[model samples]
Target: MIRTATPADVPVIHTLIRELAAYEKASEEARADEKQLREALFGERPAAFAHLAVDDESGEPVGFALWFLNFSTWRGVHGIYLEDLYVRPEARGGGHGRALLTELARICVERGYERLEWSVLNWNRPAIGFYESLGARPQDEWTVYRLTDGALAALGSGR
Candidate 1:
């Protein structure tokens, strides 16, 4: 079963995030603070939303998807940008991942969103194949960029 996540699920969400990092070979980089996660998800103005996928029989959370809305100026529509999607290692191959993605697509369709998109590490061949099987194509022409910590602070300092 897939359902929207509530603030009470922050701890589980954080744990799943760490699990995802470990799967991606970046366990040390997984440093999401639980309090911050709760605040971000349930604040006065939420920055993102999350969905949880649970085992129907056990009622245990098997996976989660965190996403936010992004505007596509060219398309003149808002799209869902999935920030993170992770299924527990033990729970993989159980259709949980696909179910989460299908729910996201349903959300997009119901809301009239232009698209549902997310990024995957190039080295993750299994993930790549899974996404491809779902008819998701990579945007090869586009490149993602980011500025954080010092660089971001420097830019805000006005040179």
Candidate 2:
């Protein structure tokens, strides 16, 4: 059962986010707070959106897909840039990941999005292969850039 997430979904979503970080061996990056999530998702103007996957019979959350809208200058269309996608280890290979991806893609198409994009850590070969199996190709000519901490400081240096 895939459905748009609401304020009530935050606690488990937060836990899932942490689980994903830990799976990637990036637990240090999990800094989300409940108050922030609530305001962001249900505020007067939302900053992001999320979808949750739950067990149809048990009613327990199994996974999530969080994303934000992005504008593609070249395509002259909006794109959906997925921020996170995760399914519990016990649930992997059982079709939850594919179901979530499929639903996200369907919603993207329904919204007339020009692209659906995301990235996986280079060391995660299984995920990479899974994405390739789904027919997604790497943007070889383009390199991902981020402006964090020192990088942001350097940008301010005007060098």
Candidate 3:
């Protein structure tokens, strides 16, 4: 079952973040603490929303998809930017990933979103293929850039 997540699911979400980090070879950078997640996700004015996939018989969570709304100047409408989508190793190839994406598409359609977008590492062929199979073409013409803690500090604190 895939449904909207609640505060009670924070711990499981936290664990999944770590697992995804490990899988992506960025475990060292996955430093989000439980308190930070709870506050950012469930406190006054939630910063984001998540949907979880649970096992049918045991009712245990198997995966999740987290997303937030973003406005596109080109499209002139709000869209859903998927931040994360993960399914447990033991649950992979069982269609959980596809199921999660389908649910998100439903929400996007129902909400009249202009587009849905996300990125996958070039070397992660499995994920790349999975997304492509869903008719997502790589925007190779465009590039992705990042700003880190050092960059943020330098930008804010001019000495």
Task: Residues 1-159, candidate 3: write the lDDT tens digits.
Answer: 898898999999999999999999999999999898888789898888899998888899999998888999988999888899999999999888999999989988998997888888888999998898999888889999987899978987983
Task: Indicate the TM-score of model 1.
Answer: 0.96
Q: Candidate 3 versus the native: TM-score?
A: 0.96
Sorted by lDDT (best first), the order is 1, 3, 2
Q: Which stretches of model 3 miss by more than 4 angstroms?
A: none
Clashing residue pairs in candidate 3 (N, C-alpha, C atoms within 3 angstroms): none
Judge candidate 2 against the unseen true structure and give its global Cα lDDT, from 0 to 1.
0.88
TM-score of 2: 0.92
Taking all chains together, each candidate's TM-score versus the true structure is: 0.96, 0.92, 0.96
lDDT of each: 0.93, 0.88, 0.90
Higher TM-score: candidate 1 or 2? 1
Task: Pick the lDDT winner.
Answer: 1
The candidate, 1 or 3, that scores higher on lDDT is 1
The superposed Cα distance between candidate 1 and the true structure at residue 21, in angstroms, equals 1.4
